[model samples]
Target: MMNGIEAVIFDLDGSLVDSMWIWKDIDIDYLGRFGLEPPPDLSREIEGKSFSETAAYFKERFSLPDSVEQIKADWNRMAWDKYMNEVPLKDGVGEYLDWCLSKNIRLGIATSNSRELVNSIARVHGLEHVFQCIMTSCDVGRGKPAPDIYLAVAGQLGIPPRACLVFEDIIPGILAGKAAGMKVCAVEDAYSLEQAEEKKALADYYISHFSEVLQG
Candidate 1:
C-alpha cells in the first residue's frame, strides 16, 4: 500500500495484539482489591505512557499507599501473565508481516509498554524474529505524543522518519508518529473501532485490518 515505505513501525498493545481490553479489567480488578475504583479517565490518561509513568499516575491520583515502583511491578506481573496466556495476534497480522518481510521492508515496534511485557507477547506469538527492533517508551525518556520512542525506533532501524510508516491504534501514538515526521496509518481494532473516524482525523491513512493493507 505504501509505495516507497522503507520501514514500518507498529504499536504493540492495540495494533498488533488484542490485549488493550484486558488492561481495563486488570485495573478494575486490582483497584477493587484495595477498595478503590479508577476514575473514568484513568485509562485515557495512562494509555500512551510508560509503565512507571502510568503507575505513578495511578498512585498519585488515587492516593495509593504503595510506591510507584511497587505499583509498576505489580501491574507488570499481572499484565505479563495475562498477555502470555490470553493475548492473540489480531487477524491477518502474521500474513501482513510476512508480506512486509517478502518485500524486504524493515519492521520495528514502538510501544509504551514495558520491555518485559513486549518480549513476553512477542515470544508467545513467535514474532521475535519478525521485528528488527522492538523499542519501549522506557528506552526513551518519553512516551507517545512526545515523539521520542518513535524517533528512537527509526534511528535503530537506520531509517529516516519520513521513510517509515507507523501503524498506530491510539491518538497519542498517531500524534507521536506525526511529530517524528513519519507517515501514520491508524489501525482499527476492536478497542479503537468506535473512535476510528476520530483517530483517522489524526492519521495519514487508516486500515480496518492488516488484510486491508495487503489488498491495497
Candidate 2:
C-alpha cells in the first residue's frame, strides 16, 4: 500500500485512535443536561460534520441555549478526561508509525475533531513530534466528504494529493480522501461496523487492523 505513497494522513478518531466509543456517551450526557435524548439517527446526521458544524447542529437541533462556541467547549470539557485516560492507539498503529518513520514517509493528521482534543491526544501519546503536520476541518472551509481538509494536509506536507494515503473509518472520510485524489484505506471501527461492506466498496483498501498494512 505504500508503493508510491509519500505521506500518510490519518483521521484522528476511529482511524488512528480508538476514540469513537467516547462520543455516544458524551452526547447522551450532554443532552441529558437539557432533559433531551439524541435521536437514533443523530450520529448518521453528523457523521462528517466539522467540530464547529456539529456544535451548530446541536444548538439548532436541540434548541440549545448555548452559543456554538459554548457547545463546542462543553463537548471538549466532557470528553477531555476520557481522551487522556481511555483512548488508545489502534492495533498495530505503534508499529506502523515506527515503520513509516523508518521509511522517511511524511506523516500528517487531517481530522474533524477539535484542535484542543487532537493536540491533547498528541501530547498525551508523546506524538507531538511524530506527525509533520496536523490539521482540523475547522481550519479548512469544509469537513469530510468535501475533500478540503485532506487536500489541505497534503499541501501542508508538501506532498501531492495522489502521493498521500489516507486512513479513515467512515464513509464520508473515505469519500473525502478519494475526492482529494488520494488512496484511501478503510479502517474497521465498532462505531462504524455496520457499514463495513459499503466502506470496503468505496475505499481502495480495507483493513481491520493497522498490522494488515505492515503484512502487505
Candidate 3:
C-alpha cells in the first residue's frame, strides 16, 4: 500500500484508536440530561460530522436547550476520563507507526474529533511529536465525505494528494480520502463491522489490523 506513498493520513477515533465504543454511551447520557433519548438513527445521521457540526445537529434535532458549545463541553467532560483510561491504540498500531517512522514516511491525522481530545490522546500515547500535521474537520469548510480535511492535512504535510495514503474506518471517511485523490485503506472497527462489505468495496485496501499493512 505504501508503494508510492510519501505520507499516511489516519482518521482518529476508530481508525487509529479503539475509541468508537465510547460515543454511543456519551450520546445516551448527554441527551438524558434533557430527558431525551437519542434517535434510532442518530449515529448514522451524524456519521462523519465534525465535532461542532454534531453538536449543532444535537441542538437542532433534539430541540436541546443547551447551546452548541455547551453540548460540546458536556460531551468533552463526559468523554475525557474514558478516553484517558479506557481507549487504546488499535492492534499493532505502535509497531506500524515505528516502522513508518523508520522508513521516513510522513504521518498526519485528519479527524472529525475535537482538537482537545485529539491532543489529549496524542499526549497520553506519547504521540505528540509523531505526527507532522494533526488537523480536525473543524478547520475546514466541510467534514468527511467532502475531502476538505483530508486535503488540508496533505497540504500541511507538503505531500501531493495522490501521494498520500489514508486509513479510515467508516464509509464517509473512506469516501473523503478517495475524494481527496488519495489511496484509501478501510480499517475494520467493531462499531462499523456491519458495513464491512461496503467498506471493502469502497477502499483501495482493507485490513483488520495495522499488522496486515506491515505484511505487505
Q: What TM-scores do the predictions have?
A: 0.96, 0.99, 0.99
Q: Give me the overall lDDT of model 1.
A: 0.89
Task: Please estimate how well model 3 matches the true structure, expressed as its whole-model Cα lDDT.
Answer: 0.94
Best by lDDT: 2
RMSD of each: 1.1, 0.5, 0.6
lDDT of 3 at 155: 94
Which sequence of candidate numbers ranks them by lDDT, best first? 2, 3, 1
Tens digit of per-residue lDDT, candidate 1, span 37-153 = 878778778878987788788888888999988887888888877898889998789999999999999999998888888998889999999999999998896878999999999
Give stretches of model 2 more than 4 Å off: none
Per-residue lDDT tens digits of candidate 2, residues 69-155?
999999999999999999999999999999999999999999999999999999999998999999999999588899999999999
Candidate 2 local accuracy as lDDT? 0.96
List candidate 3 stretches off by more than 4 Å: none
How high is the CA lDDT of each candidate model?
Answer: 0.89, 0.96, 0.94
Q: Which pairs of residues collide in model 3? A: none
True-vs-predicted CA distance for residue 69, candidate 1, Å: 1.7
Worst 10 residues of 2 by lDDT: 141-150
Residues 152-208, candidate 3: write the lDDT tens digits. Answer: 999999999999999999999999999999999999999999999999999999999
Positional deviation of 117 in candidate 1, in angstroms? 0.7
**Which residue pairs clash within candidate 2?**
none
